[model samples]
Every structure is written in structure tokens, then in C-alpha cells.
Target chain A: MESQQATQVVLASRPATARASLENFRVETTPLPVPGAGQVLLRVDTLSLDPYMRGRMNDARSYAKPAGIGEPMPGESVATVLESHSAEFVPGDVVLAQTGWRSHVAMDAAGLKKLDVDGIEASAYLGVLGMPGFTAWSGLEVIGKPKAGETLVVGAATGPVGSLVGQLAKLAGLRAVGIAGGPKKCAYLIDVLGFDAAIDHRSPNFAQELEAACPNGIDVYFENIGGAVWNAVLPLLNQYARVPVCGLMVQQSGTLQHDTSADYLAATMRAVLTRSLQIRGYINYEFTEQYFDSFLREVGTFLREGKIKHLEDVTVGLENAPQALLNMIDGRNFGKVLVQVRSNASASRS
Target chain B: MESQQATQVVLASRPATARASLENFRVETTPLPVPGAGQVLLRVDTLSLDPYMRGRMNDARSYAKPAGIGEPMPGESVATVLESHSAEFVPGDVVLAQTGWRSHVAMDAAGLKKLDVDGIEASAYLGVLGMPGFTAWSGLEVIGKPKAGETLVVGAATGPVGSLVGQLAKLAGLRAVGIAGGPKKCAYLIDVLGFDAAIDHRSPNFAQELEAACPNGIDVYFENIGGAVWNAVLPLLNQYARVPVCGLMVQQSGTLQHDTSADYLAATMRAVLTRSLQIRGYINYEFTEQYFDSFLREVGTFLREGKIKHLEDVTVGLENAPQALLNMIDGRNFGKVLVQVRSNASASRS
Candidate 1:
């Protein structure tokens, strides 16, 4: 595939605000290079488009480095090994790689994790068993420190991390109250995800709805989105409530500027004071060193036993990567969104 | 004293915003009555003027009750028992009570803690040996968990809580950086309080000053004033920073808001995610049931040993109580402001 080239999206410019157009990114066809002595050539199969990517596009200090201008956007992708000079992998083995927004790329063998797609689809590695799942698992288990009778409230409830958070809360004997944008996600949260209560944030009476849903104020609020959703959830948090904040996708849309009035600081501090709340911010990678083993074993077992259900909105081909990512950023993606870079025709039959 | 009525201040109306004025209070000269079956007739000696009273002045729900209309303002006071009908206390005994702003009050013996002055002034019970000091101690020791070699940054550095926080951080072998308004308070923090670094929040380059002071990013930020000071300090916060928010006195002055700009929240969230920052709000009362004994023993000893220094700005009479409290809310009080309602000429001396 070296002569045929690799497809990747690179940052063309920085976004000024929430209304950033797709013109900020450009797709480039580059020559795929041969693997080095300890490297493997990955044929990208599924790419995970996450909300955190919005933070990477801006030239600001965050948990990770911003995607530099003219760099391949950072992401996680499930790939198949097309060629391997490393002893660790075979040519036809399926793997997960950091080769982002691409059809084919060469990377160190150490960077890839070998995958088993037994009963689950290969794309499941990008959703249920991948970064999002681990992010939710680690944040909830470690920082949240949820107890059996405690109530756990999570926003973006239908998304990969949030869906698992609500379900995991229930599995741990905590009341799970899921907050989602629309009725559809709310319905799915109750019927499919088995959340104790689901509130539609789209409703005008969202604050009241959330209060009604959580008669016993929330003990742990898994803060994935921080905007009006946070405003609605803050008052309902119980004393000593633990908020493990992992994502702020809801604030990416410039709504934070509009929503955060002059009293926003005072209001937030008041809530902090009254509730004695613990609002912790975490990135999945920081906890990975300590939590990866437990997460891998427990999540793997849960997936195998059909205890945790995962959903994905898969898009085909490398050409549609930009729009797929855009759709995901706009919250249009129903679950984890992935791109099918190259079809594994035989894997479906196997 | 019973024949001559005692003066009492009552809450006339609730404040909407920064509109809280002395006009919202009314002083009534009511006839003093004898103590009930299990109560004591106490002469108020000192009243604590804390910034948190601003919250109580408003009708909003908080950690404590709002001072109701026509009801004497709720407060913590060191009073001398003039008449006792309860088996727990005798006449002329100095005790602490949660009575409102009154020259004399009829109180239950169960609602009071006996004062142990020892080598400390009885007035210190309303400041360093009381709630303010306990607040700093509990938050720093329990929530901030100041580890040796870590840097602790406290805003409103010269206040009762912040002053003690800086000193306690020092005692724990942690570097203490204090942020206070003006050159004088900054000087007091370094000279009198013995903080490792003291920066004036009033400086034009306050953020830069804080950055230069804390070469190692802040680990424990005792958030007392959450406005511009917080914005300046937020960027300097290191990963795993424990922010034990005590009060937002600066914000209560009806000043600046949190930097809710998308970029700011994005940056804050990124820092939190990357560093695993833990921001927990706390009230000293929560720890009283757990740490009161150790606190009373340790802090009590520190005061006797001259290890902890305390400052107070006393407003002479009961008539000056409103202005004293108002000044405290406005950050004009140099230290703990006490209203001497009655003299303790014949009380047991330390």
C-alpha cells in the first residue's frame, strides 16, 4: 500500500470559536512507508472520534498537547497488521493502534495491542473495549469511589463512556440517573441500559426534571459535559458528592461563554460550599497505569458475559472521516462513532 | 439587668444581591427575661463577624439557616452566664453559644461549649480557637492533605482561615504561598504569618507574580476568595492539586466572575484531566465530630506555645455590631472582629 498511499486528516488551521467550519481540517494522501526492524504496518479498520479531539485542535495547554498545525489529528484506531518486521505480531493479526485518521500507517509494535474479536465485532475494540470504555471505568471506579447505596448521575448518557457509567453504577448497586439531550436516549437509558432514572435535558424544566429523577440528591456526578447540564445537576448534588469530570464536550460549542453569566463564579462556589462537593478532573491515561489491569480484566469479562452492552454508529470508508468526526462532535452520533477504513471480509464469516 | 431591657438586632428583610444594607436590620430594646427550666441567662461578650454571614443574610438555602425576618441574627458568641437555671452551668461562667446578635440571651446549656481560656484570651474563642481556626485546620489537614515538599497556595491570606491555613501548611513541612490584597497584607503574611511566599492579588502582574513564586505548581489551594484571585491561581495549579474551597469572600463583594470562557474551561478541564486535580469544598463543622478533640488539643497547645499568632479588630459596643460585620463582609476588618456586648470583670481568668 506504500505506492497506493495512506489517507489522513491534518490540522490546517486553528478554530477561533465554536462555529469553526470543517475548513480547519484537510485530508491528505501521503505515501505509506515500510515498517522498520521493530515496527509494524497497520491497515486501519476502525477509528474512534471522541469529543476530546476538540480540545486538541486549539493551541492551548490541556492534559495533552494540542494537535499542531499540519499534524495528523490524534485518535485511537483498530487496525489489522498488513506487514510486521516485529516478532510480537503476525501479518494478518488484528490490533489497536494510535495510527489516527488513516487507512494505513507504520508504527512501533509496542504501540499496538492485539485484539480478539470472538463474539463481538472488530469495531467493538474502538467502543466497548477501547479508550472510551476504559475512560469511564477508571474515572468512575477510582475517583468516584461509588458506594452501593449512593446515587450516580452521568450526562451524555447514551454515549460510550456515559452508557457504561450508568450501567456500571447499577451493577454496583447505586441508583443511576442518566441525563441525555433527547427522549430517544432517555428511553434507551431506562429500557436498554437499565438506568434507575433518565432525565431529558432538552426539556425546559430540566432542573426540575433532574431534581424529580434524583429524589435522593446525586452522590456521584460523572461530568462528561459541562454547560447547562452542569447548572442543572449542581443543585441536585448531595453533600460530599463526588464529580469525576472527564469530558467537557458540552462547553466546546461556545455555550459556556453565553451561559456563564457574571454570577457564574459565585453560583459555582456557592454550590461547592453548600454541598461540600468533590469535583475532580481526570484523564483516562493518568489512571491507566494503576487501573488498566483491573479495567481490562473486569471490562473484558463483563463484555464476554453480556453484562455491559455497547453500541456504535459505524461509518464506512476513509473518505467520510471528516464528516463522521464532525457528526460525532455535533452529538449526532448515537454511540461510539468509527470509520471502516478497510473491510476484513473473512472476519465476519469467522 | 432583667429590669433593663437588652438590645437585639433582627433581620428586617432578605438581600437579593449585593443590596444587603444595615437597613435590612432593626435593633429592638426588648425586656430581658429569666432563663427557662434548662437554660441560662447569658451576657454576650464577643460576637464573630465572618464573611459567611452574607450568605445567611440572603434567603437562599445554605449550610446554615438564613436569619429570618424579625429574628435576631444567628451567630457564634462567647458569653458570660449571669443567671443559670440549668444543672450544667453556674453564674459568671464563660461559655460559647449560637445565639443571635443580642446584648443578653436566654440559652440552653446543651447548646454551649464551656470555654477553656488557659493562656489564650477569651476573645480568641471567636477567632483562632473557634470556627475560623478549626475551618483552616480541618480543610488543610483532612482535605488538602498537605504532603511535605508540596506547595500550598491560599487566597485571602491574612483572614482568620487563610492565615491559619498558611501556618498549618508550614507546620506540615509544605511550602506556603499566600495571596492577599495590597502590600500591607502581603507583608503581614510573610513577616507575621511566616508564609514561604506572599503575593499581592492587587498587583497588575498578580498571575505572573504567583507563577514566579510557585516554581513548583500549587498542590493545595485553600480557595477563600474565588474571583480574580482564583483565575490567577488556577493556571498555576499542578496535577493532583487538592483545592479545599472554604469561602468566596472576594466574589461576595459583587466583583468579577469565573473565567467561564470556553478556552478557560477547556484549559481548566484539560489541566484537571491531565493532572487529576481534586477540588473539594468543605465546612469545618463536618470535621468537628471527628477532629474536635485533636484540634482542641493541638491548636490549643500551638496557641499556648506562641507557635500561632492571632490578630483581631474589635468594634467596641453592640451598636457597632452591624458595621463590624459589614466591614468583615467588605474585607475591611484586619482580623477577627468581635462585638463586646458586656464586660467580663469577675469571670475566671486564664
Candidate 2:
């Protein structure tokens, strides 16, 4: 395996703002590592591009460590185990690994989860069956706890996390209101994803539209976009509403000023005192150990039975990863952004 | 009963700022009514003043209805049952009721809670065993989940809710850091109440003092006073910290200017997303049914064993109720603000 070469993207510098240029990344070739005892050597098939990766570029303290300068960009990936010295895994087995922004990686079998893509695609393990899906599931079920006849509002409604969140709410017998940038995505949410209503945040009457859609008031607001959408949703949240803070995609460039957050916080506090609002924040990793089995069972069943549906915005090849990531942060990708490094001939059509 | 006159306070008008004058309240006398079936007529003995009442004075929609003009001030109070037509209670029985700012009230027996003073003072029910105590227990135990070795910070350190919160956190094996208005209260928090450290918010070096106190970073910021105290506590909170939105006492009178509540909210949302914070808002009523028995047992045991010691700022007579309430909101009350309308010989010496 030392003769085989691996392609990797390294963080060249810290980004000052959202206009993160590719000059901050350098693709390098390294000798593919051999599997040590209890470790597996894997060929990466697809790397997941998420909004959280943008935070890693900055030298700020986050839930996870910021990717230091010159380190490989960290991310989750779906890969095939090429060779393994561990009893748990074998060659030709598809698995999920933290191979990060690379075409190949060698890691202990303990950290890598075996992906059972029997009738499902391996890339789905990176999105709906992976972190993004679990984020939606945990935030909604554990935090939001949206009940039947209640309202749930989620921004970036067409993205992997938000789309699944809205769908799950609808399935839970609640009114799902989706907020997306364009009229097309809004239309896609209502027409295809079965959300009760879709509010186009790009529209001049975005706040008004959101107010109109959430007639019963927003009982559960999955706060993923914390900028203008937050301002819009603030007044409409019902008494005792639940706000599960999932992401802050809109504040990537620091465009949204911080002055408005405190009033909302005061109002939210007042609401909590009066209405008993519960706003809890969680990363999927917290629940991974406890809820992994149940999440895989429930969400996996939902996907296989077509009870839940997800769209993909595939960015083909390792070279397009940086651009794909940029697009993801900018809301350019319509769904889960997947960087397809290698493909199986049989699974290509799907 | 129809000939009996009841003195009450009405909302004369709304104030523009924090310096609410006596003109804001109009004192008037109205005829008392007789109790019908399943009802009790009560002579008020004490009224509990809480920060939430400040929100009701404003025209904003909250968990409860705003105080209407020409209506008596709303509050929970301890009273002697003067007359009753229900089998649930008899005349001379002491009980707690939401009788507002008045000398007497006619309430449904079902609406009143029988006050079992047994070995404790009646006013203690309004502070420790009542709403404020429940607020602390429910918010801290259910939301904050203060663990051993973790630090818990709370503002308005000498007040009923905050004082109990600190004591409770200490009992749970967590270090308690308190924030109070002046040096005297800070002294009480440290020397008397046994808080690990107390920062005087009114001091010139408040922010620095707060930062210096919490070496481990605050694991539970039991937020009540949402102003400079929150500003100081925000950046110091550890990852995965819990913030129970209990009150916004700092913003009660609307005198705050150039206040960074918006920035705090944005930061809170970002913290929630990146750090996975659990910021929950709770009303004591929501948790009463579920935890009341356990609270009575726990808090009752603490009080009997002298594990918790508290001070009472007793305002003797109903005539002083208005000023007492105003003082409590202005941080003039050093401890639990209890308006004593009637005397009990067993009252503990202050």
C-alpha cells in the first residue's frame, strides 16, 4: 500500500470571512498507509461537505477543534476497506470513516463504522443516514419534541438537515413550514417534500410569509440559519416554543450583526418564564453512542420505505471538493453535498 | 360582605423607563363580594412580589395576560380564610391564593392551596416552598443538571430564586458563583450563604471580577438578570453548558440602553450550535405537578436540617406593598420581599 498514492486537501490559512478562497487549500500526494494491528486501510468513495467545516477553517474554539493551519480538512467519509489487520473488518467492505478531505486513509477499525449499503447507496451514509440526518432527528425528537397539530419552522428547508427535519415533523403529525432562499427551492419543499408551506426567504415579504404559514405559531423552530431568518421567526414563535440551535450558516461571513440577538434572547427569556420555552443545542456526536442503533433503525426504515425522501447535489471528483464546500456554505447546493471521489460501476446509475 | 370595602392598586399608566413613579399606580377602594358555592372569601396577609410582574405591566403578549387598566395588580399571596361555602375548606384556615394587590379577595376554593405551616412560617411558603423555590429546583435539576466539579453562576444572588439556586447547586456538589448588585449582597452570598465566590455587578471591576471567579468556566449559567451580568457570564460559559432562562430582572423596568441583549442572543444561538448548549426556559407551574412532592420533601428536609439559611425583607402592613414591590424590582430588597398584611407570633426575628 506504500506504493499507492493518496490525494489530500490541506488547510493553507485561516479564513477571515465567508469569501473563503481556494488559495487556502493545497492538494498534496502522499504514500497510502498500510493497516497496522486492529486498523483498516480504506479507499474513500465520497466525502460529506457540511456547513460546520467552514468553522474549522477559523482558529476559534468550537465543539470540535479548529483545523490548524497545514492540517488536512476534517470531515466524515464513506469508503471501502481495501485491507484490514483487524478481525472486525475485511477487504471490499464498505464503511464510514473520518478519512477527512482525502482520497484514502488508514485508521483503527474502532472509529470506522461498517456501512450496510445492501440496497442503499454508500453516499446516503454521509447524509440522511449519517450526521446530518441524526442532527435533524436528535434536534427534533430530543429538543423540539414537536407534537401533533403543532408547527415546526426550519430554515434552509431544502438542505439535507432542514429538509429531513421538515419531513420528520410532517410525519409526526405537525405542520411543517420550510424557509428556503429561492422560490424554486420553496416550491420544491412544498411540492416534492410535502411540507405544509414553504416561505421564500429571498422574497421581500419573507417574515410576513412565515407569519402566514405558521398560523398556530411556531412551536418548534429548528434554528439552523441565524441571521435574517432568525429575525423573521422571532416574533412568530408560540409561547413555550422550542428552538433547537443546529447551525449558523448565514453568519459564516459575519454579515449578520450581533446586536439583534440580545432582544431575542430577552424576549425568549420572557417567553420561557411565561410559556416555558425550551431551547437546547446538541451535536449529533452527543447522541451517537446512545441513539445510534435506534436512529439507524428508525431513519433507515423511513428512507428505505420512502416514508422519508432526500435530494443530493453531487460534486464529482476530489478536485471539485473545495468549490463544492464553498457552494454548500453559500447555500449553492440544493441538498446534501457529496464529493464523489470513486464510484462502483454497479452503483453508478443510482 | 357587599358593604365591606377592599383597598387595591390599579395600573394608572405605563412608565417610559425604569424610574416608575407612584403615579403609575392608582389606589382605589371597591366593595367586597360574598363567596358562592365551592368558593372562599379571604383577608389577605401577604403578597409575593416577583420580577415577572414587570413584564405584565407592559402591553406585550406573554405567557399570561397583561395587567389591564383599572385592574388590581396581580400576584400570589397568603391569606386567612374569612368565609367559605365549600367543603374543601373552612373559615379561619390559612391558604395561598392569587388574590393580587388587595386587602381582601373572593376566590374559588379549588383555586387556593391549603397552607400547612405546621412548623414553618406562612411567608416562607411564598418564597422557599412556593414559586421561587420551585423555579430554582425545576430549572436547576431538570435543565441546568449541575454536576459535581462543575461551576454554576447565577445573578441577583441575594434574591429568593437566585439564593435558593446557589444553595441547591452547592448541595448537588457543584461550585456556586453568584452575581449581586452591591458589595453588601456579594458579602452575604459569600460569608453567609456559602457561595464559592460572589461578584458585585455595581463595582467598577465587575466584569473582571466575574471572569476571575469562574476558573473552570461556568457549566450552568442560571440566567435571570439579563444585562451586564449576562454580558460578563456569556464568554465565560464552558462548552456544553446549560442556561436556564428563568427571568430578565435586569430588563424589568425597560431602562436598559445600548444593552447587548441582541449580541447575547446571537452568541447564545452560536453557542448552542457550536458548543451544543442546552438553554431551557421554564415556568414553575409546569413542573409543579411532576416535582412538587419531591421538592417539598427535599427542600423541607434542607430547611429543617439548617442546610439552607435565608433572609427576609419584611414589609410590615399592606399599605407598604406597592413600595416593597418597586423596591424589590429596583434591587432595594436585600432578600425575600414579603409584604406582611397580618402578624404571626411565630415569625422568625430578622
For each candidate in turn, the TM-score is: 0.75, 0.85
As for candidate 2, its clashing pairs are: A260-B262, A261-B262, A262-B261, A262-B262, A263-B262
Interface RMSD of each: 2.9, 2.6
DockQ of 2: 0.50
Model 1 stretches astray by more than 4 angstroms: A1-123, A145-152, A181-186, A196-219, A254-262, A315-332, A339-343, A348-350, B1-123, B201-217, B255-277, B314-332, B339-350
Model 2 Cα lDDT, one tens digit per residue, A1-350: 22377888999988777578888888888888777888989888898988778888988875589997888999889988888899999898999888889888889999978988876888899899888899999989888887999999998789889999999999999999998877799889988999999988768787788898888888999988887788777778777789888788766656444346346666656666656677777777888888888888998888888888899899887777988888777656788989887745523542
Q: What TM-score results for chain B when candidate 2 is compared with the true chain B?
A: 0.85
lDDT of 1 by residue, B1-350 (tens): 33367888888888766757878888889888678899999888888777667778888876577888899888888988888888989987889898779988888889888898778788888888898899999998888999999999998789888898998889889999998878899999999999999998778788899999999988999988887777788788887898998887655565545555534544555566657888888878889999988888888898999999888998877777887787776667898888877644422341
Residue A177 error, candidate 2, Å: 1.7
Candidate 1 chain A: 10-residue stretch with minimal lDDT: A255-264
- The residue-by-residue lDDT of candidate 2 on B249-331, one tens digit each, is 66654533226534666766777776777777777777788899899889888987889987888887666677887887777
